[model samples]
Target: MRNLIHVLFFALVVSFSFSCKEEPRTPPNILFIAVDDLRPELGCYGKSYVHSPNLDQLAAESSLFENHYVTVPTCGASRYNLITGQLPKNPGDLSNQASVSNIANKPAGERPTTFMQELKQNGYYTVGIGKISHHPDGYVYGYHEPKSDKIELPGSWDEMLLKAGKWGTGHNAFFGYADGTNRNGMAKEVKPYEAGEVGDDGYPDGLTAELAIEKLKSLKQQDKPFFLGVGFFKPHLPFTAPKGYWDLYDEENIPLAPFAEIPENSSKASLQNSGELNQYKLGEEKPHLDRVASDAYARKLRHGYLAAVSYIDAQIGKLLDELEEQELAENTIVVVWGDHGWHLGDQKTWGKHTVFDNALHSVLMIKRPGESGQRISQVVSTTDIYPTIMELTNVPSQATLDGESMVSLMENPAAKHWRNTAYSYFRRGISLRTPQYRLTKYFRDQPPAMELYNHQNDPYESKNVANEKPKVVKQLMPIWKKGNTGIFKE
Candidate 1:
């Protein structure tokens, strides 16, 4: 009987050892949410006026990057840099067709074009909804043309989906309105802002959220880890949202552009006309570099932007709730990133084609379960996201990337020996944002070819002190020149 008891104990110990040796650690799933033309102006970012409760909550649970900047200010180019993990190699790389013209047109080579494709190669079931790449529906077509069969970012997505709704096509749905019609078909007769009397599903973004939730439900049933990319289209153009969101704010109290005037000593060539906003010809006001919008009109526009933001916020909240309901939140790494920032009215501009801080600084938040939340102030670029994800997922990458892995910074916000710099390219110029100064060098032969703004004193960037601080420019020029990448080389 004593020998029998000893045999049972030995059997139990051997079984436990075998189980421990056989079990493998499961990698965390990635929920990547990208918002178009989103600026870092939320309650979590210290803008108490903006009604972004959902983003605020996510920021509370994640590492909120205060000084996060994009490589390019435009949508497609910026997203290209984010996916390819490379800087602008040529002039065409900085355009909106960077993805379709470069990656989609070419055959799939040995290297993956995007990090998502890398994840796919590493056994991740990748899915993309809405505007994940340059094209809204992951197709190659003009905004007014019929959707084509050519795919953008080929071999990247296992399933690329977009519910265009009544707009017919993804591009039309992108610039869509409350009604079934869109800006492309309306012949520039639409207004820039709309407060539709309908539910959340009245807009394309609503449908995007619903589809994303459905995908999440299905993804939870999959055996392998998934990388789900959900991109929201609102707050991008024709700022349209449900009336409930519009009611959340008072139009009278909305703040106007603090510095509507151009920067002193800054050349007009360094700025762009409010061309994107003025495309909506039916708007009540037209903003130009020299002409600023009236106070009432500016407030109205601000109210529209805020309403759209709140509407997207609600959609994000729905996604988060669904993630928790599916029991995926605990094992998923959630990342909410903005393609680029929009100038509501900074520097008398209303678009994101410039190299100013407002055009470059966007929203970036990352949440890893079981880790404490932090607000990282280190200057980081969108290119860094590629390596960061690779490290986070423990996926091996063979592609030559331009950005470095920021895992150390994400692990510790106040990390020592960290490079505090971000580079942005646009409008024939390459701008570098350090901890204290923003130095820009324009390739064009224009007056004030070099511009510098010290963030410590002129946070608004109301003045260019390049001539005033020649030594500072000389000190930063060598570092900023490295970002040229031969795009502006003669």
Candidate 2:
């Protein structure tokens, strides 16, 4: 009898131990959020002006990347590089319809494999929402099907104009209905009735958030792992947000650009360039005004941008809250990234066209199950996201990705010698950003442009030390060339 009891207790102990020791499930669901044209100006990145409480909370719980950059500053180029995990060879004049139409119009299998396609192949239900593409067609980024049952939402201003029928002049001015007939009759600057209320009926970000919450609820009931890409279309242009968000910041309290005064010897290459003019389209409608002389107008523009950011942040918070409510937070990996950075009157440039820090640097935050809450200073690019996600989710990706995976850094935030420098490029300019410096070289056809900023000493990039630091420039120029050649191989 004694031996029988001892054997029974031993069997129970072994069974319990095995149950506890069974390998924890490694396949984690992925929640990927891509915000458009967002600069690293959040409270998490040490900016005090932007009210990003949810993002700040997320940073504290995630592995925050301090020196993350985009492959290109422009919309189409950056998106193409990010989705393909490769640098985009200058599409040049071939970007028009005549060139693209001749190529096959088939979906994922016919084209280069995207990160999304890889996920779908690995038995993950992949879904995309909102402005995932720079174009209106929205078939470019390898999404095989639309996730939502609703009719496709209008993504751009042109689409909105097509629906509303001559709504307002296509300019950055307060727009209201000329006749008080509908919700369009409401003042553009008027606050919404409530914080979460939706007016104007067709706000894309709010609609995207709504659709994502519905998807998340559905995924919760399913047994299979999933990949959800929720793309927000706000804070990009038109700067239209719920009026409550616009009311969040007082115009008087809005912070001015760190360097509002353009120095007398500022880069003529930057000044003569119509980068800002192209963005604002001043001469097309109204006479152009000097940015320096129109600080008030600039402030209004900044206010609108901040409002749009806050509105997007709120929508993101809603989706994240749904993930938590559905008990997916423990098993899901969330990555929030901006496709590229934007410019708000920086260097007299209004949009993302230059190789400046404001244009090139993007915000990347990765929150995994068991990662440390620390900021990583190593330089990384948006190109790295594809490989990192694949590795983390244990999905097999056959495509040759250009980026080196940072999976090691996720576990050990202080991994040494991971990467030395990160590279970003525009049409004819290339920028190499290291921990201590940034060096830019523009093609001679445009202007004899060179900018060198010693980040260790001058974080704001105030002084142009290119002429003074000839030896440094020579050393860094080769590094940039090597990076470009190594990545593109053309």
Candidate 3:
């Protein structure tokens, strides 16, 4: 009878051990979504016109950053910074060239290590879809098989529409001139859309979303975690979206550009140097565009831009819904970011180029599992994204990354020792943006020009107090120089 009792006691102990055993935790998957030329006009960003319910909902579930910025305002330059976690210092300003050029000329094994490459090294499957780069194929970024199934939007109207016999006009859209001679020379060619066709119907943006969904479904069947990048090309361009999205906003009801009243003491060079004054007019140069008469046209252009933004938001909503339906939300880390911001008549600028706040500031939303929804007002840069993903996935990064991990901030939004200021630079200028101040130094052959603004008092960046506050400029200059010490050293 004692032997029988011993056997029963052993069985009970085994059962208890089995019940208490911990299951292995699966590494979190990463869904990296990149949008081109998007500004901080989302519903969560306090903009009334742009309807980004999906992003706002994601923000509700994630950590939204209010002061996120990019290293550069151009697509290729900014993306290179994010992927490599390093400042872009390509010779000949090669960093801002189209992706195709960068990839083709990339030195063997010298390609800055990308986050996707690190993921692949750590045993995660990496998949890329859509305009991830300007490259003809996406392999340069490290996907094993760069999927090329993306749909082409209308090509240059001159080439695809007129020359192909599909449309009457065969001219390129008016992008700002390259030489600054015509001020309206053909920047690039774009296919003309039919009278009522939506931008996404023919463009690759919708197809990119479809491919992302398909990739996610395939990922669900596999046991391994994945790094899936979905890039959309809408809102970058010929101001096209489906007729349905356009109809959502009445042109008459569209808001006008916020009135910009230059101070009497402001330099004439500052006012005349506005990029908006020099944009292409009907695909040709009109030097008088900077004069007062162009205001009405500028208003119409802004309306089209806002409509494009809203349309892209709808497509984003579709992708987010799929994640929920597939049951991937709880296990996936969703990161939504714009490659860079766009300009809409701010500081006499119609597009990105200058190192102004409107160009350098971008929208960055991160949704990590188990994190409460909140806004992080700390200054952060695109370079931080790669390191953050590495920490979350438990993956070993092979390359030395320059960005500090924001995992601490993710766990505790009030975490201290965060960056005091974020750094941004272009070819001829460097900008230092902190929560309270912004200082810009533009280098020319002549004496360097400076602009300073107290963000606390002038949120619109309307005033330049550099002359009035020389001491502040002197203090910040060294700090900015220190942050950029290693940038051009190599």
Candidate 4:
């Protein structure tokens, strides 16, 4: 009887100890979707005519940022700020080759090249598909050059995959047309828009989405967490989509840019001749700072852009569906972000490069594990994404970041004492976007280098009120100088 009692007691003790042992908590997975040149012109942003149902639905279920702005107005520089969590320190930091010059082939120092690299160091499986970095395929290659073995952000991604299909290379597929022709091979002879009669797979973004879904299936089998960054290339340039997306809108019903004319009392340095649009040599009409494109042509281009947005929206829907099907939605953090905004004949410009609101404002939505969807109207910067991701995953950072963690804002978007400020740098100017005003200071030898627009009175930014509002300029100058990190001097 004594032996029996001792045996049972020992067994009970072992059972209790086993039950009390803490199982290692699985880290939350991250699904980061980056869309190129996607402005705040979607249905969620109150553009009823734009067919972006997928993104709108996602916004309804996620924390939608109403005043999210990029650190820079261009693709590469903006993405650089996003990935590095740093301000522009040199001229290269403001250009398309920012990634290649600063990050590629560099040995890991005290600071990792990107937040993705930091995640990898912390035992997360990082995978990048398509244009997560400056290069279309995340490789160091020119638009016309053959694919190279050189990785763009080495050590950051465990796998950087690109399915070029009939286009031969990623860069070619980026600007590819329906017939497998690209602008690089044809010397920019292609038109600015194409409505192909084929299906979604006819374009590279469709291939990207399919590849991401397949990857998710594989990731589900892994015993660790993943940080998958899937980038969609659309609505960027040569606005091309399947005929089905183009059919979603009526050409005549598409509205033209309301503020298509240049602002009153603004310097010519503040505007460009739509040079990026004219690069499409076969484009029907050329728009200049003084010469606005005809309304008919403007509507057509806007129609093409909306179609591209709808097409990308479908790809995003596919990704979200796969996440739910894999049961990853419950444990994963999903973020849909736009690299930068585009100007569809806004201020008579057809591209993004200036420091205007059209070029700075972009889409930002974050769906965390337990958070309910809400709209955050406070101004936030692209650099804030880095620290936010790190904090969410509980990954420690080795280097100091420029932007503050938005975790507090994410938890309580209506949290008081929130910083409602965002800064955008471009065209030799640093533009500061406060809640009710936009003040831009340009570094130039010319006069009237400052431009201010009060959103409280003139939301359209129709006039430069720097001379009219001296007190406002004085109040904003100190904040504006914070973002002028000597890149202009470089």
Candidate 5:
């Protein structure tokens, strides 16, 4: 009788324990969309004429950063900043070959920790597609080199993928046009812009988006949340897009850059004479610092760039729609960021590698599910994205990130104590953007070594007031020097 009573008591205890147990909570997923050479020209950034419906819609539900800056102006270095959350401190790290120059050379024990690596360690299915790193397709080698077993982001992703369509190789695709002729293949005889009557598959961006959508669907089947990175190549060079996007723009209506002349009192060292622009031997105009590019050709280039933007937007829409279809939008965190801004004839120069606003300022948007729209006016760096992602996904990471967490401003756009200064490095010089001025100081110890622009008075950046603003430079000099410390640890 006593044994029976004890058994009944134990059964009751087991039932009580089982009833009190809690179900494990699912974590939020991350969709990190990296757009190349995308400046703040979308409708969301108050550019009334640009057609970017999909990204604008994304901005409606995201935290739009009005003052976002990249650590480096070039491709590979800027990506290194985004991936590793560190600023470039050496000249070698600032090149387009930074993947091969720096990261690829480092031993596994001495490499910096990528946030994506942290996510993979913490049970997230990390995936990469297209130009997430320097290489157009995330595999290594030159524009014509064959694919090998080189991985850029070591230990970061479970699967790193690149699908180059008719263009053949990633390097060729990067410099390719609508008719499948790469600039290299054509011996630089390609025009600066081409609007071919082709479908979305006519460009590599479409194929990248398609691949990402497929990966998204597959990622949903996994038990853990995913970190999917999708990168699109467009508006970089040899501006090419489908006919439908090109039709949206009227060539005559495209406006030229307001500040087409070089800045007053600025040294020649601060500018490049559209060398990248001069690469295409078939271009309609030859752009030089002393001579202005033809207005007609400038309009054509802008038209092509806009078409590329719209094409990528349509591709982005496809990815977003897929997320909704899979019911993953409810718990996924979406972030859209450009590697760096492009100089569309601004500052009488073309291409990046400049410390000017045209090259430094880019686009950044972060959307948390159910979060209200907010515009963050405080200046933020690209490095901050790593910590922000870590905080957003609730992942535990011991990674030492160079950037601060942007979550406070994400919650409250006007949050205090937020960093108001942004830093960008190039060559031996570093540029600092504060609330009022942009100060650039060179380290070579030459004449006209410093350039300063007062943003309030000269919104166009047509003048350099460094010689006149000695007191201001004195105050900002330390801050400018403080930006030079993102040196990687061995």
Candidate 6:
């Protein structure tokens, strides 16, 4: 009887121990990356000539969003719309200073203070490196001013770092070249593009990749899941990359921008004056609404831009390779996004300040471990990325996400009940994109205040048929007004 009792007790102890043994459940890690002024001109996006094998491989294993659009065509505004998961609430929010001029002042207790802050509060290690916000170095500082302790997205990051290198401050680095000379400091005397004879490390983006790789290893040692953001500055302005990337392209064979003339019957207010390109004082040619850069100079600019794209692609490949090396690729979710598309001489413009497709469309690719590659052609907005991240990680919070998740579309490209429209605001113009149309309503215009383009008929948006297509305008009118509620001053 004594032996029987002892055996029973031992069995009970063993059962309790087995039940209490903690099952290792590693939550999915998120590797979120953002590139500045990158359009979907890569080989994966079917731009046959672009030498982007790294991004092509990524897209091959992920859900490629062919028609991704940003809320605002400019950088700061588009990034704000993305990080906050909201539309531009006011006209001033459409400027290039959106993060600093708009969001950095609000209190943390207020509306969702950045999705990163929410993730950090929910026990995830959140780290931001390089131009994650309006500021290039992830901190707030005046143009040409020394770095300050004031952070843009306060309380959002457990670690914020940047190797500014020879670029000095973040703002200066925002427009720096491979030789450590910046656009502003050089007094605009430097050429708008450069093909450095040095290696990849001669540029800031190479150093950024180095930091990201180190961070990934550090994050792996932690017991909790992490949200790591690595923002690359390239293909933005003062296009400069190593000579090797430039050699990858034949400058003479590089194609000219598809659309260079302004749309017919569109108001002057509908297009930008290309002043952003003008800032490159040494640019061989100036582009305008009525005139475009010389074809030769335009080809040179395109070649430089493509070289920068390939350089950034190599850096991205480095980070991804390290993720797989650390055995983290199977459990990590990878996202590669471009803030907004740039006009490569489209619409007689070279910058991204218009409501046109060249300025609004961007790159959005997502890779879920163990998932096959699929293409989603629906019109999705950058604002949706925040909610999609939350859904993927199963993290709960008290936030009302303005964007919807793409989980269903990721699983099935033909998913039903998906959003068929997206909205973007720039200057006084409000552009709405449906599956088959691109409509614009300029708040500052009179009687002919509306503009419409049937994408089914004119993909280049070369004509505004608003007057001819009253029926289509009537159908999209209500959507335009509804989209204007928070964006317009009224």
Model 1 regions lying over 4 Å from their true place: 1-22, 110-112
What is each predicted model's overall lDDT from 0 to 1? 0.91, 0.66, 0.64, 0.90, 0.86, 0.86
Error of 1 at 124 (Å): 0.4
Per-model TM-score, in order, reads 0.96, 0.80, 0.82, 0.95, 0.94, 0.94
* Model 3 spans > 4 angstroms off: 1-18, 90-94, 98-104, 136-195, 198-200, 259-289, 446-448, 486-490
Model 5 quality (TM-score): 0.94
Task: Note the residue pairs that clash in candidate 5.
Answer: none
lDDT of 5 by residue, 300-352 (tens): 88899999999999999999999999999999999999999988899888788
Q: For candidate 3, write residues 130-249 as lDDT tens digits.
A: 555443124232222223332111110111111101111111111211112111133333221111353453334555566677778888887778878777665665565666666776
Task: Please tell me which predicted candidate would have the highest lDDT against the true structure.
Answer: 1
Better of 2 and 4 by lDDT: 4
Q: What's the lDDT for candidate 5?
A: 0.86
Runs in model 4 with CA error above 4 Å? 1-23, 110-112
Model 6, range 1-490, lDDT digits (tens) per residue? 9999999999999999999999976789999999999999899999999999999999999999999999998888888888888887777677766776655666655544678877888889998889888788878777768999988877888999898888878877778887788887888887789999878778888989999999999999998889999999999988899999999999889999776887888766787888877888888888787777898989999999999999999999999999999999999999999999988888888888888899898999999988899889988989889888888888875676678888877877887789767888886778889989999888774445788988898888889999999999999989777677466654
Q: Relative to the unseen true structure, what is the Cα RMSD of model 6?
A: 2.8
| Model 2: per-residue Cα lDDT over 222-334, one tens digit each | 76788887777657765667677877788888876675433333354543243333334322222121534266666677787888788888888888899999999999999
Quote the positional error of residue 167 for candidate 2 in Å.
Answer: 11
Superposed Cα deviation of residue 68, candidate 3 (Å): 0.5
lDDT value for candidate 3? 0.64
Better of 2 and 5 by TM-score: 5
